[model samples]
Target: MLDFTNDSSGGEPSSQAVKQDAISDQALLDAYSNAVIDVTERVGPAVVRVETGSKTPGARERGGLGSGIVISPDGLVLTNNHVVGSSRQIRLRDNEGIVTEARVLGVDPDTDLALLRADGARELRYASLGNSKSLRRGQLVVAIGNPLGFESTVTAGVVSALGRSIRSVSGRTIEDVIQTDAALNPGNSGGALVSSAAEVIGINTAIISGAQGICFAVASNTAQFVLSEIIRHGYVRRAYIGVSGQTAPIPRRHAVAAGVDNKMGALLAQIEPDGPAARAGLLPGDVAIRLDGVDIHGVDDLIRALDRDRIDRTLEMEVLRMGRLRTIDIHPIERKPSARQGSAP
Candidate 1:
């Protein structure tokens, strides 16, 4: 939840020792800037210009511009679903100045991913997909998109972090996210974050307010899955369990001090009636310790575990119940499309 949206003031330290940190950071930036842009420019033409028109009651037509990626040869485009939310008209312009009307193939508001199709478009270029699983801190990456309607704009930086979760303006929590220092602006959503080889590793999605140079993106794998669903079902099928919990690892000192009396797992603070947790015999005071054999450290770990699962998938969970450890097998329910905006439990 590091807010990196709008602060442009450089964070320079006011001390001599800190000068070394600044020097090292600058060196990394220099390397990234010198090397990444060439690849971005070569592959950027496939990223399209998205123009959306909307009208409200008693209002004139409103228009906005965003960016999208070509995902298929016959003109399947991928973009942030928020960009096209309820728009009356959508137009796509590729790098060659060819503009065409497009239609939404599917929209997944939960992931903020949408698929669009432009008829009769041929020989469309596609960025190679990089394995998000292989992304590591300090690895270089480049973001290409249209910010302020400038097509194929490129910014370079390293993989600042991973496994982040951010809530979009549309109120859906995007999870398993990537964070970087690449500059992403208003019109950059759904553009590509590529590696040195021009493989699209991430989808530039959001930037935090009041912070400079910090940006977030959806990992390419997540985008691929969500986009595929948009093409097939016009929606994503997400699994849900009925429990609300904050992620905190069991502290060793707290365990020692309490002598087995205190909970030693993820603290469950709420439960919904007849929900998956309640139906599975879990209650308010339970602390979930493990999922399917994976140790649960915090909320992100649990969320990452459950985010993409299908409905009715059985998950083995170990929990702390009344000062004792207990195990349960819980079947996740299909979270209705309407409830996607609500907390799970």
Candidate 2:
């Protein structure tokens, strides 16, 4: 105590100030720990281990494992389609080692999502899906999954990015993906990516091999759409106007001639033989400017225009061919399960 109170004379903080700072730092750390613990306690029960066995004649013994999240009290579980592969029946095990069998209700390979119902499960604990569209970069997130066969593993990180597109195993582009830094491993697929409020914001999907802190999840909004479609129709229905194209810049003159203000459009590189677009006289080298009065600024826009509602419905397509605007009426058809050769827009 010789002159401890005079420590501030040299511009150094006094002992009391140092003590207060230490306390504040500890408080922040405690808050972070509490958040993770609280989320785990609230949502961990809904996380389950999904195990699938190969139905191959000689590979019946081969099996795979991943994670899943219970979304309905009556036992609807959501997981990645790749996790379950082509298996129609699988086993689920929760954190408490309760094992149950679940049957695949529906699967959408394009979005890498699958829905399952536990046999006779009722009043089960489940988690609520949150609006992933509201997530912001740098926001804290907690991942609860069974990583590498470790049941109920927990990892904490931040939302690194959003609106990302990733290719699924089925060779389809999954749009509006959520990128996060939360650690993920093989068995983590199909688990829940939760917010601080314990809402499931995403379904853990992929991780860049050999990369640290880089992971991706399917956004909850996409999952919700897939869920509803699967529940109502038994499969995801998408309109298909067979055309292969890419986004290309529109010529200023062509833009003016088309009476549209889009700077870019989908350049039709190929028209599927006898397909809807070809049947409607749409040819290669034509740039699509609008569909059903919706501006087709790019290939994505064109894809979005051909929604489920557009299937089997006559729609007007505006295009610029040889600098001249042309309107073509085409009826889109429902895309087939085996038809994954080209884009259907």
Top model by TM-score, which number?
2
Error of 2 at 160 (Å): 1.9
Across 1-345, the per-residue lDDT of candidate 1 in tens digits comes to 786444446764446547888999999888766677667676787798898995589997579889998877788888887788777589888888887888987777666777888766467777666789888998888888899888878888899999988875544568889999989999998888888877888888888889997899888898888877766666776677877888655655555544543334668888888888888888887778778777776554565567545367888888766656678988888765552244452
**Worst 10 contiguous positions by lDDT, candidate 2:** 336-345
Q: Report the backbone clash tally of model 1.
A: 8
Clashing pairs in 2: none
List the candidate 2 regions with Cα displacement exceeding 4 Å.
1-10, 54-60, 170-172, 248-264, 336-343
Off by over 4 Å in 1: 1-41, 55-60, 86-88, 108-111, 119-123, 134-140, 161-176, 248-266, 307-314, 339-345
lDDT (Cα, tens digit) per residue for candidate 2, span 76-115: 9999988988776699998889888899888888889999
Q: How close is every model to the real structure, measured as TM-score?
A: 0.72, 0.87
